[model samples]
Target: MSDPTVGQLADVVERTGRLIAGITPEQWSDPTPCSEWDVRALVAHVVGGNALFAAALSGQTVTPGDYADSADRLLAAFRAPGALEKVVTVPFGEVPAPIALHLRLADLMVHGWDLAQATGQRADYPDDVVEQALAFSRSALPLVRKQDGPFAPSEPVDLDASALDRLAAFLGRKVG
Candidate 1:
């Protein structure tokens, strides 16, 4: 399995956003695999996630205020037409580029499934990226819930299921 590039992630994000944007209003308000978040909230999470990562890639130290502002901006952008063109280049610092790319791919691939499941749409991510994500998620499980703050709860997820299922479960979502 090879790590995906930032370009690949951007492409995936665009496709995923388009898929989500096409959902009916009723579907947008429906429950998701995330349990706590509805479809709208799930979209919000994805938009907010993009903003947060954008800030990170742009070398902004993550703060609650930054997250709020960026998230608001991103939500508005998502509401507008042709707003998925934003690209964020991650700065891995001491880490290898492939590792960072793999992480971003995992993030996009998982969230794509989240949106798809919420809207009763079928989604199948690239198998190569999924495999990379599975390996990354499995290796990172010990630190998932233990990470600094603002962490999503994950209970030592296993990558025994399909890639999408494993990715969803790793991110505290149930497989539909």
Candidate 2:
């Protein structure tokens, strides 16, 4: 499948970030379908994921801590006014632009649901973005299954009876 446009990915991240930022402190500490992670921790996780994705695009090897650090910096930047674009344009390589964009898009789309669950807010991401993210996850499902680490699941499964629900289920969240 073709990668989403950069504007689309940026919109996904921006819109979801706004939703997440609007959440209360209580929600930040609430549990997510990720099991071990709460909303705040999940935020950190997504930030780390972005950092790793950016680094990968830049042809650099990155550790989880690097992603966490990147995430921390991003959150701080977001808390400031008029910093969205700068924060989103974190340094990334150009060689594999499509993959990097997909990574960013999928991260925002899935985490948006996580944040919604924790905050008791209902959100719907763009259908095109959700569809692309689902396709991306499905493509990587097999490789993800071979790892001997803790993860919800990669194979597609039944879910909440909607596109968004299916997308969430594919990402290991039990949303109905």
Candidate 3:
């Protein structure tokens, strides 16, 4: 039986790829919500992250290629038999493969939003996918904040804000 998270990861990867492909030449230097990383840098970070996760899961060092290639490698690594059932040491620390999957999913989803926002595109990720990513972000936020990780402290959003908005805010991205 296939793990459902892998399917969700694939969907997020595909959506993120579309967002990357849509970036116009002029927008490559545009500032994203990530503060420090502009459009090009944000995409590079995501691609690098895919490579990192793929390497962790596959136990093989993998060089990151373009967004499509890196994303494909990540999906392949996760799809390997017993991959999700094994523990892996990602950059953050040793974690169950499933948690690592969620971490990557949430990262891609948020960065997809960032890319869309930077390029004036719509982030049309499915509601369920955003919700699942949001859930994972909520669970991981405390530890992330405590560790003084890359994410800033969670910003406040209205109670009725959209899940995407909430996710971005929770990840320390300002939501307008």
The model with the greatest lDDT is 3
TM-score of each: 0.66, 0.71, 0.95
* Candidate 3 worst ten-residue window by lDDT: 140-149
lDDT of each: 0.60, 0.63, 0.87
Q: Which residue pairs of candidate 1 clash?
A: none
1-176: candidate 3 lDDT, tens digit per residue = 12238988999899989899999999999999988899989999999999999999999886989998999999999999999899999877899998898889889988988998899998878877788878877776677566456778888989898888888888888888
Per model, state how many residue pairs clash: 0, 1, 0
What would you estimate as the lDDT of candidate 2? 0.63
For candidate 2, write residues 23-127 as lDDT tens digits. Answer: 786677788877889888988777677666545444345545533365444343333443333323333323244554665677677778777777877767877
Per residue, candidate 1 scores C-alpha lDDT tens digits across 1-176 of 44555556655666675667668977877887666788777777765566655444444554333323654443343333332333434432334435544555676677778778777776766666677687777775555445553336653555567767766776777554
Error of 3 at 90 (Å): 1.1
Alpha-carbon RMSD, each predicted model = 7.4, 7.0, 2.3
Candidate 3: clashing pairs of residues: none
lDDT of 2 at 121: 78
Identify the runs in model 2 with alpha carbons over 4 angstroms from their true place.
Answer: 58-95, 154-160
**lDDT sort, best first:** 3, 2, 1
Q: After superposition, how far is residue 23 of candidate 1 from its true place, in Å?
A: 1.3
For lDDT, candidate 1 versus 3, the one ahead is 3
